[model samples]
Target: MTDPGLQPERTHLAWRRTALTFTVVAILAARHAADHPAALVLIAVAWLAFCGTAYTRGRTTTRPLPHLTPVVTVCSVLALAVAAVLVR
Candidate 1:
């Protein structure tokens, strides 16, 4: 059986992974945005903000912020999707 004590650690690790993924994606997007420098700047800024939030939330020992993480995640995803379409 899984140990309950490990759940929070797993969750934190998952968030860290997510932040890492976002960072990688941001780098790729920047490389692709050479023709659209303004958009690249905006995307990089947004991704950095989201990454910071996710990383911090993951490290917190207290309860998850009420509804904040999900909202930030969703907004970041939608922003990235829109940026992808526009950049293309």
Candidate 2:
């Protein structure tokens, strides 16, 4: 069986990886919206919000994960997807 002590470390790493992924995607989306200033601003704001939640969760490893985190993440991704499709 896996060592229980390492589980929190692994979870923390996973959240960091997720935050990195969000950052990369947000950058790409912002680039895609370069021609539209409003869209760029919106994307930046969303990115900031997502990174905030991710890092917050990372720092509070002792607490149970917030129910809203996944919902927010999925919604952000969906918004990005829709924006991409509409842009194209």
Candidate 3:
């Protein structure tokens, strides 16, 4: 079997990629938010935190720390909700 750290490393990299995607979408939302800025703010907050969390998860060796995926998934859903609200 692979070293235990290997799975976390892969999960961390996935989170990083998720963070990148969120950042790009956040920027796009900001550019278009002149009429609806709230969504952009939410997106910015979620994405920035996501970036930080992913970075931390990648570096830390401690077990029992919160998993990055669920946190990210929650934030992503929130972001999506914000977008949906903005669209309506």
Candidate 4:
């Protein structure tokens, strides 16, 4: 049997990291949008989609799904969104 404590610990740490990165992206996006108003809508839309997906994924009970799955997805989305917005 798997260690129960480890599972939750892994989940919590993974989520925490995800939340942190999300916050960072939000901040950066806000800053970029402030300087370039054109990016505002894109950033907002992308963020909303990302958060919605993350929430939906969290509600599922898929076995062996690493706690970092959603977190990584969110982080990657944020990174790409931010890069795209900044570049544009």
Measured by lDDT, the strongest candidate is: 1
Model 2 agreement with the true structure over 19-62: per-residue lDDT tens digits: 89989988888888888766676677678778888887776677
Writing each residue's lDDT as its tens digit, candidate 1 over 1-88 gives: 3346877788789988988889898888878876886667678777977988887887773666868878887877777776777688
Ordered list by lDDT, greatest first: 1, 2, 3, 4
Error of 2 at 5 (Å): 1.2
Of candidates 2 and 1, the better by TM-score: 1
- TM-scores for all candidates: the values are 0.78, 0.78, 0.62, 0.52
Clashing pairs in 2: none
Please report, in order, the local distance difference test score of every candidate based on alpha carbons.
Answer: 0.78, 0.77, 0.69, 0.60
Q: Ten residues in a row with the worst lDDT in model 1?
A: 1-10
Candidate 2 has an lDDT of 0.77
TM-score of model 2 relative to the true fold?
0.78
Superposed Cα deviation of residue 18, candidate 3 (Å) = 2.5
Off by over 4 Å in 2: 1-4
Give lDDT for model 3: 0.69
Pairs of residues clashing in candidate 3: none
Residue 17 of model 3 has an lDDT of 86
Candidate number with greatest TM-score = 1
Q: What digit string (tens of lDDT, one per residue) describes model 3 on residues 1-88?
A: 3356577677667767876887787677676765666776676677677777767766564544566657776876688578657956
Better of 1 and 2 by lDDT: 1
